[model samples]
Target chain A: METEKLFEITAYTENQVGLLSAIAGIFTRRSLNIEKLLVYPSQIAGIHKFKIITRAAEAQIQTVVLQIEKKVDVIKSYYEVDNERSCREIDDVRQFLQERETESNNI
Target chain B: MEQKITGAEAFWRSLLEEQVKVVFGYPGGQIMPVYDHYWNYQAQIRHVLVRHEQGAIHAAQGYARASGIPGMVLVTSGPGATNVVTGVADAMIDSTPVVVVAGQVPCQLLGKDAFQEIDLIGMATPITKWSYQIRRAEDVAWAVSRAFYIARTGRPGPVVLDFTKDAQAGLVDYAPKPCHFIRSYVPDPQVSESQLDEAARMIDEARKPFVVYGQGILLSGAEKELAAFLEKGAIPAGSTLLGLGALDSGNPHLKGMLGMHGNLAPNVMTQHCDLLVAVGMRFDDRVTGKLDTYARQARIIHIDIDPSEIGKLVPVDLGIVGDARKVLAGLTERIAPRTTREWQMEPILCDAVEKHKVIEPEIQPGTGEINPGEVVACVAEAVKGEALIVTDVGQNQMLAARYSRFVRPHSFISSGGLGTMGFGLPAAIGAKIAAPERTVVVFLGDGGLQMTFQEMGTIMQEGTDVKIVLLNNNWLGNVRMWQQLFFQERYSCTRMLNPEFTGIAQAYGIPSLHVETREELPSAIRQMFAQEGPFLLDVHVREESMVFPMIPPGSSVDEIMLNNEDWFNYGD
Candidate 1:
């Protein structure tokens, strides 16, 4: 039996103009409403990493990833279950900075 | 100083390198640089001055459809670019390869909303396989080469390259390098051995099997191999509208066409077949009448080059993502021959053909006047299945599709998915330009012909031999037929008041003949074909004729209206 779960798809793509919208269009066509999207320069100089989060069944996410990887600019793409992720958000750093500032004030 | 060339010079140089011989275009303020330099290269490459931008694109589509090569279209910016959106969408849906070049304002004034400037890349993105705007002159050669490669390779469609005025005029060091690879784009996905094994097993096991194919066979050039496979397997075949000419119309293995207004056998027998081997076609709603009841009993073996199309509309038991020709060749090796005879499958199909007999009188000549089907029949008899047939959408298109016999590949070209009414005339011009050796006949309605009638000037200027059989039904027969059948007979604006087409053709320096009665059609068609140059034969057809075997809207494939009684009974 297939059940829905959160899946994270990470892709490394050439930083070209309009490529973002092209990737977004893939998600839109699949009826996969993206819960989160993050774009930043990858380890390579000219390549960018796009990480998208959506809730879908396993078979559906695999199909979506194959479609994303088919784009000319996309270097590679893969989907992972929620537990497979190890990451941080800028919002978490902001909270840590606020906590340190309060500690300094208390001192 | 190192060698340097202008952007326009590089652009033209790249086309020469790509071996593009003909380009359909119209000039305006923004595209003057290319036009100015065009004279220098006129002897090497020919540029067709189309009357409108839409004609350029549709001609490109027709050229692509006829020749299996990427057609080229060059248009000015703004409205000129927008006018081609319809043809671009049509090419995208039908998978015809075309490269569209549009000139834009100078780079500095791109987003300032300058005169004749629009966001062409943004507008063309959804319609084309790829869209890009080159800001630098150095990018011209690479971009043009990539545009051609992308448009012509793997499931071909239209691609757009937007050129700014500065890019078209600027000079830079010129070096031409052919683009053979993109880092991430894979045109052919590797087919799996396991999938083929499973498919071979399914075909060998299933006793009642049916084959339905589409344009992919032509795209991959698998027609001969596919014919052999069908003959060996003893599987009956059906075709999509675009797949009409993939095999000989009279091939014994061919059952009939499959769609909304397709032949009765394939549509009726699809659900009952145990194994459905669909090649090259995506399961469009038009092909699959009602999704819930369409081939539900069958285990579908879908073979196509496009991976995404697999299991998109209908589920697949064994999906092989590869070129149709390659996959069919592979399947032929693995699957054993079936000894079952051809007559085993004939009884049901013969029954379907017998029921389809009602279509004979509707198209045949009657006492009232010349039937539209008779006009197509006359042309079919005259051409004898050798000419390339292009049809405009609606009544005329349906009649031509139903009545005509197509024996050659890529012989039937029209706007199937987009249903653009103005496609036939300009596309016929493209077909003639691409395949000058073949006889190109266009079947157009009075309504559709008027939409792109200006193309008569292009045909006259080019001096191409294209026979136009204008099926002038005074009413917009398809729309009126629908309103009469489904919409309580209120035909609001479907009635057309047409001008004298013969007179219109005369003004464009093309000869024409008119035939309104049944007796005149046969001779008029011969006259139209006998002319060495372009000629138009205006055929006046009965206003009340309706195409039969039509599957009513929101109805299953089995529920086809064969006659007036079927239409009336469904209303109750």
Candidate 2:
């Protein structure tokens, strides 16, 4: 039997309006939950990059990446394992912000 | 090198460049500039004035579906754009390509809650494949080019463009550039040979294999290819509602339709087949009742243009992403002709049960209370499979999908996914305009006719001859059937308080007739077709009749109720 896995998909495209929501709509229609998402301007001028983390079967995510690439606004989109992931630690960042809050209260 | 022009002129010129012969539109406040220009270019592009903007979109869908070309729509801001949301969503779900351009307030008044202003781009994004807000008249050509390209490419769907009023009024040099490609927007992906091999092997080895398809077949124009593939392999086929005409319905290898309210053999075969080959059709809930139980024993293979639909519903052993016709050609190329006698009883029993139990009793020719099925039968007989049958949602739509004899592709047009109620009236007009040589028939339920009956005026003015078959059951028959079976017969608002429909048709200057008995039903249908112009036939039918072999909600395929006895004998 097939089991679910975490997938990270990275997309590059010329920055245009409604590109993010259009990509998100692909995931939303399939009922796949995005674990994390990050989008920013690429190193190349006028080019933007997107990184999405979703938990689903590999085939499902592959289909998602394929759909994302079908958008004319999207330059290229593919899935990978590590570089595709958003490396920010969830609890560590939260704890660091909490410590900052405590120190500010003491001051 | 280029002449300057107004936004409205650029819009019309760009459409002319795109070879858009007709556009369904309604003029409004924010859309005045475009209409003002429309007055000048009525010769080049025919602007069909629909009573409501919603009708314009549906009409555009019919035109697109019939012509296999992108349909076009023009509506004003706010309510005009929003009114078409349903039809846009319908196009999106059904993969009908349509380009909708709505007027906006202006750039200066952006987000100020101006009159006749709404963020149409935002509202249309989820429903359309793509959308753009044209703030500058200079960008009009670029946006129109991209909108048409995107709307008609890959999996075809609706694309909306909202232009600011100032843009429509502004003057600029318009140079229409044909959209070639977006860096990543690949309309046709190469079919994976390995997946094709895998599917071919499975089809060859499986004792009992089933072929199921949907609208994508018609969209791809793969009817001939699908027929060759099925014939070469001697495979039995079933169709979703949209896939009806993709294969000759009378083909002996055709098992029948498969879904809720589908015929007997195909629905049951879904559970029993060893291998399930889905071509161009999604495994929608209606097609696969209780997915947990659907095709459990079968190894599944999906061939479709859209990758996202591959494993969205059912687990796939092999998923191929390509156009249906191309992929089917590739797969058939890999396998030699093979035949299997596995489960021969399945299709034979299905045919026997359908003919003996369903078709025989329903259409045995009687003159008592005029049955809806008989009306469909008579209309089908009158048209002789030559006309395009467009229908509004509810029982009438299902009956048209199920009973109508559609021998040609694009002959059956209806709101399949969104199931819009008043879709037939204006859509029939568009279909007539698209193919003026062919007859166009509009079937509307009592509940549906009341929704957009005003479009009769548009029909009279345009002089597009369409025969309107109104099956007046005096109730919302589909939902009422549901209430009868599942809701303990507690009829709520199912009953429709209808006006004198013939009077309403006469008011629109269309020849109208009323039929109450089976004796005159066929002649009335023939007379409607014989009329030189638009005609309306208000057919009074059995009040409680519903499409049979329905898979009750939350039930499995084998649990389909064949008829009233199946429902009554086996109570909820």
Candidate 3:
């Protein structure tokens, strides 16, 4: 059995109605209880941030993060061991979108 | 200056901006405002009034699959909204593009359980790509545009817009908000060049490689790309049930359908292949039985547009997240061409074994009551694999997928992920409506037909020219087969005392034919096609009929059951 650990998942998203419940529903479906939850504005204008702490297997967290990022309003999502300060994925997503814009412009 | 218009008019304007030509819908109290505006927009858009809300959504799904455009649905709140929940889930799992706008009570009345109001957003959130409630008329255009944008892009699925009565009645400065981009959403993911190189290297190194694909190919319009990729590599390919029409059945590299009750060649080769390349298909349990033992020896590469689907089920050595067309084109450019036909010829042996043991007996018994496979085979012959075939769940779906040959893309539509029983009748109607030039044929079991048989009225009213072929075995044949094989043949409630279906068809003004014997089968199918409008050919097949070359539940793909007494020996 894979050992369960407490992970912190952060998601940057568009401020859309019912997004809170929509994101909460994912954790509900997996029966993973959110230990702590925080929602506030991010440094990037118009983007909101959600910091959630939950206990789950590494595999579950990997899929959960991916599923969170799958939401239409979610810009970028990542997970890390509690208090590890891992690299942010939002910058990478921004870079990816910027490159796509450049490519489309060239076309 | 933009004219101030009611939200109702704004809704119609939004659809017009999207270039939507048709919608499948039924209206009631809360949504009456939107329906009222329909009178003015009637010149621009056509509305299909289905018998039920469930029929509306399934029809919409069929339209999307058939036309390669996002299908639209509009229904009232409460029961109307609740009715579409099944199809919303079906569309989600199938990756179909549909936008559903359901009416809601006035903004103030929400949460008070007002008359004809339900928590549609709450109920639809989990099932839909995006579910939002439009409480203000000003938000109508924005919400509708975003709904279409999200529903049609990036692994497309259903979207729900809960329209409140107050919002519909309020005034808005309606200018079309055509949402071309959303900062939060990326419809197309960029492919990694290094990943493509690794995939090419693996394909070049492997002597025996197998390709399993699903509806993603058709959804991505990657049929030509897939064919070119397979041809360049000399790789044999098999399609999932929904992936049937993606590759032309006549394509030389195309082996057959894969999964339980799929062909012998693909299922056996799944085990023997050294490298497995899966594209646009999630590793559904139905396709990969006993996952631990499935393709254990193969170095697997899974390519899909949905990032979450990459490693959700079957872990892969390389997972490419991009459109199938883009990825396949990239791989085709990178990979070396192979001219050898030795490994590709492997299916010949399995096909021979399947034909002698399974195919001949099931499709051409020569001396029995009409077998279901025979009916499918007869239709395949009559249509010459030129019809858009839709099927209800159970034995009908499997047999149609197995026997029906396809020469075109998007010619096969069935409820693959959700397995909705009453999907066929309405879906065929939608397909026929979307593509009136094409011949649309639907295969339905006796059990599934009655679930939404009232849609025959819709067919009658719309004058839909669908060929309805009822495989009337008078039993829940799929469940019965399971009972016969695994449950000591208890027979339970699987048996049904079915009503005279021809009489029902006659009542709906559809020309009908009942064929109980083998001699009448061919002419009945010919008559079905030869007629102008709708025709129902109810075939009374053998009650004890079974689909053979089966992989009993919880078994490996190669461990196939040829018949009641014999298991397929791979060596033979």
Candidate 4:
């Protein structure tokens, strides 16, 4: 049996309703729990990005990412082992978003 | 100036633009607007009113499988939408192309839990090729076209469109939105020349090559290509259940069906071959019993249109992601032609053993209660392998697959991947309606027949010339067989006190006959085909009858049970 580890999955998709649940359902069907999930508009116009953190075997994560990309709205999806550097990068992105929100409020 | 029309009118117009002439549907409160407009388009589109919502979707699946077009379905919200979910899942797994439009509660009532409101898109997402909610009239044309396009292209599957009541009643300037492409979707991947060359080299080098295929060949319209590929390599091929009609049953290169209840030769040859070429069929557990032992001696090559399916199950040495037609044609051109090989005689030996041990006793039993396989053979003889054959799940399905002969593509339709029990009757209705010129015969067990027998009402109303053959055994024969073998005869809930089916057929205004003795079998089948709009022939098969040459679940393909006391030992 393969060892389970925390993996971060990134998916780019069209801005369509119910797609978040559609992608998440793949994980749920496999009985994998999501530790964190973030859905937001991406830098590319009309595209949405989803960052999900889950613990699963690498083989299961490969299929889950493939199934997520199989959805009609999903443009692409990738998964990789989550590490301290990647975790810091996620926090930095969150902090950058908060700073942008504060600046917009000041305006 | 754009033509302003209601969303319901747009729905009909969009169907017209897609050249869809028939739709199977049921109506309720939320979908009343669409039904109201359906009246105006009656002259252009023929809508078959099914007995239930499940019947509607299964019929659409049948129509799609028969006509090689996306079957269209319309249903109301809540129960109506939920009812079709089983058939939708069936079509998804079987790769049948069907488009379903279900009415939802108005947009405002979506999340508020209003009357007849449910999250249909959420429910359908996992099972459909694509699922979208049309909340506005403007999105109807686009969504409908997109749904049909997605449902019918590449590896075909079911698609769902949730039409809110407001969308049905809303007005929009309607224009045909023809969808041929989606930016995120690549329906057909290009064939890789390097992979084809590698596959050809492997096929050429292998001493014993075997091919196991599935419904992908028919879905790709590559029956001729498959035949050519097999002929060029002089390879024997076995078909998955859904792949039955893709190759003519009499084709010399065609071995037989492959699965738990499939033929002896293919299962045995699977263990003996050195190279395995799989086309279009997934490595379903039923086909590959105990995957660890499945073709372990063979270097497998999997060719499929879907990228996810290539390495999903049995890892392949060469995985070609492309249309079956293109890949087969490419490989055929590259591979060398062979005349004969030592492996060619393997099936002949297996066939001899099977004919004496299994086939003769089941299909040509001289004395005793009528056997289910006998009925299938009689029907095959009556139709001369010309009729469209449909089957429900379990023993009847296996018997039909074993005995029925097909000379053309798309002549056999069954619930393959999902094994939906009630699929046969409604699917027969759809097949007959889709191809009125051909005879449509459905073989279902007593258990499966009752699951969707209400579709007889639909058949009676539409005058669909479908022949219904019920293999009545008074038990869920397949499960009963398993119980006897694996579960120590603990029948559990396998027994059924079946109703007098002929009486039910009579009530539905359908001609009926019941065959109990072996003598009545041939004539009863003849009477069914003699002169009929629709006829039901129920044969009471042996209560303890079992489908033999069986690969008991979890056993390797070669570990076959030939009879109650005998197991097949190769070269015995």
What does candidate 4's lDDT look like per residue over A1-107, in tens digits? 78999998888788987898898889888899999999998766677889899999887888788788788778777787945334443444455445545654664
Which ten contiguous residues of candidate 1 chain B have the minimum total lDDT?
Answer: B563-572
TM-score of chain B of each: 0.97, 0.97, 0.99, 0.99
iRMS of each prediction: 14.1, 14.3, 2.4, 9.4
Give the Cα-based TM-score of candidate 3 against the true structure.
Answer: 0.97
Q: What lDDT is obtained when candidate 3 is compared to the true structure?
A: 0.92
Top model number, TM-score: 3
Candidate 1 yields a Cα-based lDDT of: 0.85
Q: Write the per-residue lDDT of candidate 2 for residues B1-572, one digit (tens) a residue.
A: 77789998899889988899999999899889999998888888888999998889989999998898899999999999999999999999999999999999989998899998888887787788889999889989988988998888889999999988999999998887787555446677778888788888888887788899999999898998898888888788889988887777687678878888788888878888899999999887888888888889899998888877878778888989999989988877876696655576877766677776677666664546877877888888887788888988888987787788877888888888877888888789888999899899888899888888888989989998998998889999999999998899999989988889899888878899999878887788878887899999999999998787788877777677778775312212
| B1-572 per-residue lDDT for model 4 (tens digits) | 97689999999999999999899999999999999999999999999999999999999999999999999999999999999999999999999999999999998877999988999988998899899999999999999999999999988999999999999999999999998877677678779999999999999999999999999999999999999988888999999999999999999999999989899999999999999999999999999999889999999999999888877778789999999999999999999999877797889999999999999999888887878888899899889889999999999999999999999999999998899999999999999889999999999999999999889889989989999999999999899988999999999999999889999999988999988898878888888899669999988999998998899889899999989999999988
Model 4, position B466: C-alpha lDDT score? 93
Q: What C-alpha lDDT, on a 0 to 100 scale, does residue B363 get in candidate 2?
A: 69
Taking the tens digit of each residue's C-alpha lDDT, what string does model 3 give over B342-386?
A: 675569889998999999998989996889999999999989989
Ranking by lDDT: 3, 4, 1, 2
Return the lDDT, model 3, position B408: 95
Report chain A TM-scores, every model.
0.75, 0.74, 0.86, 0.76
Give the better candidate number (2 or 3) by lDDT. 3
Better of 3 and 4 by TM-score: 3
Candidate 4 residue B255 Cα shift, in angstroms, is 0.8
Candidate 4 regions exceeding 4 Å error are A82-107
